[model samples]
Target: MAEKIKLACIIDDDPIFVFGTKKMMQYTGFCDTFLIFKNGKEALDHLSVILIEKKPIPDIIFLDINMPVMDGWQFLEEITKIDISETLKIFLVTSSETQEDRDKAKKFSAIKNYVVKPITLESLQELLPTI
Candidate 1:
C-alpha cells in the first residue's frame, strides 16, 4: 500500500462533491484526516486558526473554483498573506474545464494539479506517488 497522507482538506460549496470525495478518499486510503469546508471563506478562517494554533496544516487541499463567499482565487490570494509551509499541496478540484480557468491556475505555483469534478478513487490513487 502507498503511504497515507496525514491530512486532506476539501473546500467546496457542493455537499455532494464533498461527500463523494470523502468516500473515495476513505476507500482509497488517501489520508488519515479530513477537513471539510463549505466555502473558501470558511476554509480560510479555519486554516488561519490552524496556523495560529500551530496545528498540522493540511497535506493537500482540493479547492473548487466557484463558491458563494470568497471564491478559490480569492482564497488563494488571501492565503498568501499567511505563512504556510511549502510542503502543502493544493489541487483545483473544480467543474470548470475552460482554458481560461486552466490558464489562471497556472499562475499559482502552489497549485499542483487541476482535477475535474466528481473526484474518483483512480485519481486519488494516482496522486499517492506525487504526494
Candidate 2:
C-alpha cells in the first residue's frame, strides 16, 4: 500500500473527465483526500484562501488547459504569485493534442509534467509513483 498523501486536486472544465478522474482516484487508492473544481478559476480562488489561512495545500493538482473564465495557464500564473511552497506538484492535464500546449506547459517551471487526456489507467499508473 502507498503512503497516505494529504490531498490531490483536479481542476478541469469537463464534467466527464472530472468524474472519471475522481472515480479512478478512489478505485486506485492513489489519494486520501481529493478535491474537484469545475474550472481553474474556482480552484485558484479556493486554493488561494487555503494558502492564506496556512492550510495544507494540495499534494498534487491536475490542471486542464481550456476553461471558460480562467484557463490552466492563467491559473498557474496566479499560483506563482501566491506564497505557497515550491514543492507542490502540479501537472498540466488536458485533452489538447497540440504540441504547442505541451511546450507552453513545460515553460512553466512550477508544472511537473504535461499529461494528455482522457487520462487512462496507464497514465495514472505511471503518474502515481511521481507524486
Model 2, 61-101: lDDT tens digits are: 89898988998889988888887654668888887889888
Worst 10 residues of 1 by lDDT: 79-88
C-alpha lDDT of residue 30 in model 1: 65
Total clashes for model 1: 0
Give stretches of model 1 more than 4 Å off.
none
Regions more than 4 Å wrong, model 2: none
Most lDDT-accurate candidate: 1
Candidate 1 lDDT, tens digit per residue, 61-106? 9999999989999999888778755555899999999999999999
Which residue pairs clash in candidate 1? none
